[model samples]
Target: MFTPRTPRIVAARRLQRRRDRDQTGRFLAEGPQAVREALAADAVLELFATPAAIERYPDLAAQAPELSPVTDDALAALAETVQPQGLVAICEQNDVSIGEALAKEPRLVAVVAEIRDPGNAGTVLRTADAAGAGAVIFAGDAVDPYNGKCVRSSAGSLFHVDVVRSPLSVVDLLQDNGLQVLATSGTGEDDVDSLLDGGHLAPRTAWLFGSEAHGLPADLLSSADRRVRVPIYGGAESLNLAAAAAVCLYASARAQR
Candidate 1:
């Protein structure tokens, strides 16, 4: 028997459904590594690429023969960019309660807010994964965590951690759980290094990273109990949102250990 061909365009309206990951709380996982990790994690592998791209990663095809494969044009259409790495897998987004994130189980978390750049947001997620953060929260109008660049930049790390998007009020709830909310700012009282180097940090801490241009909004900055900065030891006046997140996350990681 033959299967129906995946579309060359794949319908933009259809792709929008993935933004929420509401059905199963899991979103689309794409590219070779991302798809591979999703399948490995038992995430729903809803789609695959044509044999041309499939041939590039024989191992994935072998592992997930059940994929609904489609052509390169189809793959590119489904993907968010021109450089289609030959794979796309949609899965449940995995919804976890905000309290679950601040339980101090992992002892560290990264909170992102108003990050406009998908690449930066994705990069932050990758850093959170590397730093062993328990979760990453995309608060405010941050870029979609499921953006194609983010899914790619994560390098499969996105699969490893719990990612949630919400408002500052939700962040306040995390604070009530004994999770310190440290907002990043150029005008912060002390550098994040000092906060980390002060030789003391709570078992559960949240790093509220801001946007590239505006940093955190005024209200959010005011809402955070503590304000911290990742000081520039060099000529640079500031750090990229992603890079700053990595530093703070790792700092918390080091502190917890």
Candidate 2:
């Protein structure tokens, strides 16, 4: 079993930090489900697990010829969570460009702009994948997609969907590709349900969502092909970024079907 001081273990532990991940172009996938998905995506470069974890998921271990067994303390050191799940994999980055993602003619896409919360960002990624979105784009000043919290929150869906990070021109890029970029707002001109039922959620569509703290910027809202709002029948003030994304993405998914 590998000790905490092992060179490989030490290197993998460095991946928990954003700077190290950015420099190495690799990130850590924690837990059995995430590791399994990363392996399926062919993104895992190396697998590290505790002896118990390797024993519990022998099939997972079999898939990784480079599996290394480590002590429980070593596993915890590699994990970002309070309670480590005992399994972690060092994975190569998988982010693509906007043009590359659009080349495949995605029917539904989720465009996240300036979102800071890693958990929310990851949940959005997971939701987009579940809703059959062809891509999930992190635009503007968004959180790092490879952030450990983001990867963990995405469960296994990070591997299931194409993820992109655009510095600034995401809207322009989507529009140039003939996609209808629809921004969401609390007081949008069109109702989300109405658009869905009317079959107006365009075939080649991208749903634009803003950050958790603030909704979309005014210029962005005005620039969209259309501004849509999810109607609130109940007394809730508003939905959070993740919840709104799930609703909008699923709506587009059902419409496309």
Candidate 3:
């Protein structure tokens, strides 16, 4: 059994940092679900699991490119959660270029910009995938999708949707690809329901979302073809980032289909 002090386990523990992940062009995926999805995507390079985990998830072990039996302490060292799931996989980063993603001509896309929270970012990615969005772009200074929390929160959706991480003119690019860019905002000219009723949401659309605190940058908001706000029926101030994203993406999904 590999101990925490083992050379391979020590190296794997370093993946907890963004710098290390970036340098190595790989990230860690924890839990059986993540490991399974990573395996399905052919992204896992190696899997480290406790004996119990190997026995519990025999299919995952059989599918892994390489499997290493690890002590519980070793698994803990590589896991971000307090309770390690006994399975972790070192997988390659799967982000593609913005141009490459747009080439698919996705009818619905989510462009997340300057989102700092990994959990929210991941949840949005998962929501986008669930809404049948073809791609998700992490633009500007958004949190890394490969962050441990982000990967975990994605719940395996990270391997389903086309992910793009790039510093580019996102609005212009989407417009060039025949996708109308829509920005989500608290105070906006168009109401989401009105747009849907008017048959405006059925076209190829890319939703631009920013951080909850700062919202979208001024230039991006202005560049978007339409600024849309979700109606709140209750007394709540506003929906959180993930909730708002779900509302917007699902609206587009409903209209497109």
Highest-TM-score candidate = 3
lDDT of 1 by residue, 1-257 (tens): 11234342343215545444443454666667787787777775465667776678887777773666675556665666566577777665653666666564556778778787878888888898888888888887777677667778888877788877777555577677777778889889878777766874636787788887888888778888788888888999888777778778888888887
The lowest-lDDT stretch of 10 consecutive residues in candidate 2 is 77-86
Q: lDDT scores for all predictions? A: 0.72, 0.88, 0.93
lDDT of 3 by residue, 108-191 (tens): 999899998999999999999999999999998999899999999999999999999977358999999999999999998998
Among residues 3 or more apart in sequence or in different chains, the pairs in candidate 2 whose N, CA or C atoms overlap within 3 Å are: none
Candidate 2 TM-score, true structure as reference: 0.96
Highest-lDDT candidate: 3
Error of 2 at 92 (Å): 0.5
Q: How accurate is candidate 3 locally (lDDT)?
A: 0.93
Error of 3 at 111 (Å): 0.7
Per-prediction TM-score: 0.85, 0.96, 0.98
Q: Once superposed on the true structure, which residue ranges of model 1 sit more than 4 Å away at CA?
A: 1-13, 16-26, 53-56
Off by over 4 Å in 3: none
Off by over 4 Å in 2: none
User: Candidates 2 and 3: which is better by lDDT?
Assistant: 3
Query: After aligning candidate 3 to the native by TM-score, how far in Å is the CA of 205 from where it should be?
Result: 0.6
